[model samples]
Target: MLMSPTVRSGTLVMLIALLRSPATTVAVPPPSSVQASAIGADVTAGKHLFERHCAVCHGIEGKGGRGPGLNRAQLAHAPDDTALKSVISDGISPDMPAGWFLTDEDVANLAAYVRSFSNIPSEPLPGDAVRGAGVYAKGGCSNCHIVAGAGFGYGPELSNIGIRRSAPYIRKAIVKPGATMPEGFLLVEAITPSGDKIEGIRVNEDTFSIQIKDATGQFHSLRKQDLKELQKLRGESPMPSYGGVFNTSELDDLVAYLASLRGKQ
Candidate 1:
């Protein structure tokens, strides 16, 4: 039936109002199987890339070896997806080199694969954390290491060692300190023109000057020309082997104590 112009306009207005109302329902389509497959393929490709480029340092399963572990839900440096991608592309200085060869899509896929490691369950620790604390105290570990700003700063700050290192890695480190003498902790001996020998960890070095922090936590800045001798004790670590210091159970307890120290949060 034919309607007047005013009646038709009123009907159209009512229809528009109804569509805009809260009661209105709209169906959104789920992602297609093909799209899902593409995503899966990207992740697979990323895993391959990681194996080729990152596995040397990060391990086959991202459990870590020379570099820090990526199996946890959170990464200290790369907290979010965007940050993760940036790290993969740019890399951390001194220790980690940048992925200058990776394309943008390659970086995305690598990030995806790294993120997948977070879903895997963390390995359970066996030692009692409380007992481990006592073991640590008895071992004189605070003489060199620092935890949550409590101990000496001669060694690396271990506030986030739990997140950075795996249980096996920590165990090995405790038993054989020389095996995993952290990067950048190079020992050196310098003999000045005055015939005084100073031995310590090399803090920083440049073209003109070198800095050293001795066993007593003293800093020495010397010019390269003024020194009679500057010897880099490569493949040597001042941190002694504790293999004979602690029994098996005590070692396990120490590992647990160190593992439980997952930063402020």
Candidate 2:
């Protein structure tokens, strides 16, 4: 393996130890030097442990996916081993899924792995935003969309969209927009006195009735209890398919441009 000259000797040793005996149980020495040595050892162990367990979901560098970006300030001051163990064991609420599957040792190593992200700088997306700007303009993306705080208000703004969504999700959104429809585009239904049902994307609602936008952009207003079946289905986007819209290279470039938006703080 081509090792970086900057890698501390202690870190390299730890890497070798991990590669040699990944399953071996060992006591982690407490930080005593209060210097670069401790940081290097922890980071090296973290790198290997992360590669073994978290790389698939969080990327090799922990950028994100099935998990949030660990490098971000959101987790900067998260508690130490005890607190981290709970989080790793119980997990954060809402958006984050449970992490109870991890063993105590796994959690410990994983916490150290997460801490490594804080030391390394995030790699920027390798693409020309300038080129992406042209592609965005000529590709007719703004016809019903927006980018970087500008463009039509009909579609949700794409500014900083790269941060909230992953590259794969973004690609999926563009290629098959109908798959993961955004919120607010959900179809709502109401029952009528005659036992009839009507449904469409609810644009507005009051105690008595609701306004809806259908596939054709046509709006319909209906009164409450005027029909049967009132279900909110945020399924399928109305955006057109982008298959063969651009060559593979263009797609790659577009993704790179989007990824580049994940800037460092």
Best by lDDT: 1
- Tell me the lDDT of candidate 1: 0.78
After superposition on all C-alphas, the RMSD of every candidate to the true structure, in Å, is 12.9, 8.4
In model 2, pairs of residues that clash are: 189-230, 190-227, 191-226, 191-227, 191-228, 192-226, 192-227
Question: Which lDDT tens digits does candidate 2 get at residues 8-98?
Answer: 8776777646643746324444643222223323445556767866676567778775344566534522545456557666755433445
Weakest ten-residue segment in model 1 by summed lDDT: 32-41
TM-scores of the models, in the given order?
A: 0.80, 0.51
Candidate number with greatest TM-score: 1
Q: For residues 1-265, could you state the per-residue lDDT of candidate 1 as single tens digits? A: 1112244655645644554465652521243322222232256668899999999888899987767678887787777776777898998865577999999879877886787787677667789999999999999999998998888988777887876666777888877777777667689999999999999999999999999999899999999999999999987778888899899889989989988888986
Against the unseen true structure, what C-alpha lDDT does each candidate score? 0.78, 0.59
